[model samples]
Target: MDGKRVLLVEDDSAQSSMLQLELKRRGFRVNAEKTVAAAAARIEKEIFDAVVTDLRLGSGDGLQVVVAVKASQPETGVIVITGHGSIDTAVAAMKAGAFDYLTKPVEPEVLALALRKTIEHRDLVGEVRRLRAEVKERRGVSGIVSASDAMGRVLALVAKVSSTDATVLVTGESGTGKELIARAIHENSPRRDGSFVAINCGALPEGLLESELFGHVKGSFTGADRNKRGLFEEASGGTIFLDEISETTPGLQVKLLRALQEGEIRRVGDNHPVKVSARVVAATNRDLMKQVTAGKFRDDLFYRLKVFPIEIPALRTRVDDVMPLAEAFIKKARVRTGSPATHFSPAAAKALRSYAWPGNVRELEHAVERALIMAGGPTVEARDLPPEIASSAPAKRRVKAKPPRKSRR
Candidate 1:
């Protein structure tokens, strides 16, 4: 806090001078005002790091000064001093947003300590603001590139559930943009100001997945070295997105159900349960109902997850969107590789539209990227596509042999 500015408001000239000298000695820029009116005027004209004021000015109380200082600059910290200290007066000063209260004949050390604490608090506040700004910049939505009805419907569901705290189950084939929709929901919800914690249920084994979601106490397992907070705890008051929920084992499903119902979770090897307020949004490609019938998933758990279900349509069903999706992917790939301008020829577009994309949007993206690298000119022709895609035409036209002729003979 060296070279920080401070405003001192005191009617006593000698005390004000001594405080100013001490603050200046500590490398602070000190400004001394003899009355509440002068302090208020000075504050209106300039911002200060901290303000120190006596309760009784020559003609007015410093409570008014506190109010004015806070009104003018809400970020500034205020400290109140009183010679005739009383419980009521101190309470009132604090209620008016005073950072600290000091009794008369205050020790310089105590005063210095309060000032140091206030400065540190201000620094923490600034850091939080900076972090929030960075998140906003990174996740800010301008224009998402989807024009297909499938993507449009997904976006609509996101908007609807973004305003509610209901658990959302997003179901789609792999690479159909499940994570993108999850982020959109988080950004539009009231929890947008908080963190969005995501975990893939299939990414880790059962034991690790449990610890990852619920955290664990020190030495909870063989490798546990310290107490670790789980994704649910870290996402408290925010959203936890569980991707590929179908991959979770039956045992873990029971534990997750309990946590969802009770709004609390127990860390592995820990007896104590920690309460959480995180909203859950789970996604999967497999049919939980089918899995439940096969005894791979719990029936009750499936119902709980489907409370606000949103099914994402496969890309093949949205034929009109193929051209747009391909164009977008080509642009993205080109920008990433610093390649020259590129476009698909009419024949190439026709082949893309006619073929069934078994791998969905992800496969189309890879095709476009590969074609961009293979095509020499600006236009990507049918020959530029992978052999699988180019051979789609022959497969579509195959005729059945004349089995009937043999029967007639």
Candidate 2:
């Protein structure tokens, strides 16, 4: 907040001098102007963190100054001051892009507080803009929808680690886009030109899982009639995403550990080992460390997969991402179903933001799709949402239930 440049536009010389002295004392660089034309010129020629102007100027109205400052630097905060303060004037000032309204003979402390708040708002707007730009840069490639600062940091980490061949372990609740992150890493890596094979370890039996991952020779098992390539082999020179890695049996864990340590795998029926250049990216919703301690998961395998761990935050933790994600999903739904729904109503958006999404991003995507289908108009209203979401009470509901009265004799 200190040393922030301010453009002061006031026609009253005495008032301008007093305000400038106070602001300078408070560590602001003040540039005083007496007319709207001078302030407009300063705004165009120089940059400022905030503009403090009187509603009434000598030559022209301060609204002109506000408009000029906003046109030049929309991020700059504008505070309007006036001797004849009224509701209409305040509303007009705000409509003209004033950040705040202050009456004449304002207290120094009040003015300072307003300035601080305005600066904070400007900073937040700037940060959101930066994050949006970053998200836009990797929009379709990352396939991630987020506005929260936490997810921004996660994306930053993804960018840093995607260039390397280091093994990555993504830990998050089910449906939190763990596989998407893995794909993002692969897409941005040197192996992006090659195949990106993914399989859910928990979705297959132990015996079949081994054959699916390590491959099997012809007639290796009862169902094996022909030679088959495993994910590791299919993904050779690329990346292999092993989702639900924690679900692998203990015996399979040893084989996985061997693959990670030695960069080799043995087919089920073959005696010779095959070298694989695939970069392994694993994910799990369970606590692998706890499984290691309980003897359910091999300790060595756990350590190998945990080399470069990335934990995704749950949807409840990144509530700021909810609306953007919902909007993105709505757009996707429109394309998939050829729906006419273009947006969510205010009530529907409120319901979305208020709900605690236990199923994370996957759940939100599905919900938006459902709402789009159920919507009658171009916008998705609260009634178009899922039953649980539509029926849930508002966040500000404070009416408590009355206690049940005993039946009178």
lDDT by residue for model 2 (216-235), tens? 99988898998888999999
Model 1 stretches with alpha carbons more than 4 Å out: 1-143, 393-409
Cα error of candidate 1 at position 298, Å: 1.2
State each model's CA lDDT, in order. Answer: 0.85, 0.88
Q: Per-prediction TM-score, please?
A: 0.64, 0.63
- For model 1, residues 256-342, the per-residue Cα lDDT tens digits are 998788988999999988998888999999988899999999888899989999887887888877888899888888988766647
How far residue 40's Cα lies from its native spot in candidate 1, in Å, is: 22
List pairs with backbone clashes in candidate 2. none
In angstroms, how far off is 211's CA in candidate 1? Answer: 0.4
